[model samples]
Target: MSSATSLPIIFVEEGALAAANLSAAHRAWADANGFTGQRGRLLALPDPQGGLAGHLFGTGPVADRPPLVAAQAGAVIGPGQFHFQGASGDPTLAALGFRLGAYRFDRYRAGKPAPVLDLPAGADADEVDRLVSGAALARDLINTPANDLGPDALDQTIRSFAADRGMECRAIVGDDLLAAGFPMIHAVGRASAQAPRLLDLTWGNPDDPKVTLVGKGVTFDTGGLDIKPASGMLLMKKDMGGAANVLGLAHAIVSAKLRLRLRVLIPVVENAISGTSFRPSDVLTSRKGLTVEIGNTDAEGRLILADALALADEESPALLLDMATLTGAARVALGPELPPLYSTDDELARALMAAGTASDDPLWQMPLWSPYDAMMSSKVADVNNAGTGGFAGSVTAALFLRRFVDNAAAWVHLDIFGWAPEARLARSQGGTDQGIRAVYGVLKQRYPAA
Candidate 1:
């Protein structure tokens, strides 16, 4: 649509409405309407003919306003083509937020059509599309129910994704997991009707710098023999959010055609209760030859991730990253919006943090805290899968996974909630993507297109 016909979105900073550069008539209208530029406050502007002309959106104060605050416009605007007239925030992030805010998970129900937003000037269209596509894929996968997205289903989905991208994909299933030295993965998922599997996907030029990603793929966490309470099981379907998010990040990297050899490892399983369910105190051998004592069957995400991380480390990739919805302690430490990042490399962590701030994906760095490693000691095995004191649950989980990595050049781990407890400016109240955008931003910087 032409700029003349499209609705213009005029952003107003909080407490600056009086000096908002509005025409005398429009200013009078805003004053009469008591528009104070409160965050998320939207006021419709009219032309001389009493017809719709534009909209006034409050961005709140500059100091506290988020980069994606412009996303609020996408959520509130009706069906029409709109463009930013005088937005003061980062234009690229604003445009990206506008697109993200228009996202909806309507697979099981009908929803309204999304309003169109003309791409703002200076925004990279390709980059925006890549990020949006990745986020949507992750959200859709996380939002799917367990009944339809079990281990086998997840395996198939990954295979299809690989095929579409021309990536080589393979899976080692059921008894094959044991044959392949993934005893912990088999033990954790053996009880379920759906067999456990480890999915591997490879893409890009093998001669390029190796970048490996591992994700915990517990499709549905019933907590096995240590079943979770009914309230905890309510959102168990999202247990595989880690796998979903990594795939989303992978998509962005491939779509951008970054110069790196990418490898993705996902240990897919369902922590279900059955006659063959793995019990607490069972010592299971991992892919890396370390025996892990199951302190609590509910702590199964780390178990599967340990095996995958071990496999990734074996290649000694230049960069190793893993994402998981691992511990409740992480949530207690830093709510759902901010995922905690743990890295062996300080430079990598700092880069990720900066990228998160710039991309509006926000990540907080949490130390690996080597002192907490003792909390996972086991009397009968190499290590216990759960913490002893329960004081540093998240720290101990990160420490447990660290035991399996010895060869990677640099490694980073993200403990993400993967769910939005409440609706926000650019995010819905359901499954969402975390940390991927920040990681992608860093990747773009590290491995820019040739």
Candidate 2:
């Protein structure tokens, strides 16, 4: 939680000797000091008193891919105020690069020593605030184990976050879920002692355009009766990634003080196997009144999201967005770097795509075709939680959720991995921030303050 990690970050470009244009001072330093400009090279310049003077890092000498300049020093660098001591006065590019380089998630253990970064002079304080806080929350949530981060803990985190912001919060827990008409949420969460609940928090003026955000909060996944292998269960603690992402997104929205009224909904549960666990053959009625046949006991994310999305739909919000680590198929299709986005509005889709590109948060849009509608067919219930054939599993899931939302002017569903496949500079190999920036960009432009 260091406020400003202002560490000096000077970049040395490689191949100066081979190039035609080179400064004598820069060339002299490079040749004498053996500065090859290889990525992530850390060199410290000390003062006359044997203290630190400034720090230097190596950046790959690619002209086209300048944004990735900070990839070398991101999370790997220790906490401090980082500065680009290079001659390039491109502060915006420097800030963008440094911001991308400063992310880290050391939840399993304490993060080792890395230089703190100093914020750039006149950096976008608001944007930086949202990015760091939201990303930290996401990482913490994804890094904890299921035993520690179950339904109750997830709800508690949300309550704590809401209270910190002075936002109003309400939760429908246990059988109260049934009484409150969140049967699916209960059915999915009822298996755990943590007791499933639908958490709703409101912020901003009541009369403002409602912007309801929903996230799947499955704290762990045993895959229910279907039970995944040990390898699959290893990372199941991150099943609540949807909830984490939503709360993370809400953190950004609230911190930025966006114009739209905000509401956050998280249906917290652990899809553990027990006699009480909902069965694959069983059918359950959702809050939206659509009866869903449980196609697979493990397909529990949709169950919780169904109840929450229905509630969001009821608000008739100006915009509705839901994020989940819902399918491996999506990961197979897009890998961990890009999340597949499903949206009903074309303009919104374009805007979000542009926003993602501009903000370094990339998302690819998948169609919400009506033809895939029948993939979720069920003989007894209105639909099955999963499609019979898994050809387009991600699309079918989106189709299943679409049943509950017909009124939202702009609705977007993000099937996010929430975990990075490998280390990518600021994005360490652990829990990662997928769409927070792109969504923030879109929201900022949509409701720019008057």
lDDT leader: 1
Candidate 2 minimal-lDDT segment of 10 residues: 14-23
lDDT of 2 by residue, 1-450 (tens): 124434456666554333423346444655677766666566665555776645556665656434545755664566555565563335554565566566655656686655555556656666776776787788778888887788887888889999999899998888999998999889887888778888899999888889999988898988988889999988788888888888888898888888889999988888876779899879999998889989898888988898889988986899999999999989888888889999999899889999887666889999888898888888999999988777888888888888889778889999999888687755767777788878988998987665
Task: List ranges where model 1 is wrong by over 4 Å.
Answer: 1-5, 18-23, 47-51
Error of 2 at 17 (Å): 8.5
Clashes of each: 0, 31
lDDT of 1 by residue, 1-450 (tens): 236668888889988986678999999999999887888888999999998889999888888898888878787788778888765477778888988888889889988888788888888889889998899999999999999999989999999999988899989999999889888889989999999999999999999999999888999998888888999999988999999999999999999999999999999999988999999998998899888888999999999999899889998999999999999999999999999999999999999999999878999999899988888888999999999877988888888988999999999999999999988867888999998899999999999988
- Could you tell me which 10 consecutive residues in candidate 1 have the lowest summed lDDT? 1-10
| Candidate 2 vs. true structure, TM-score | 0.91
Model 2 error, position 179 (Å): 0.9
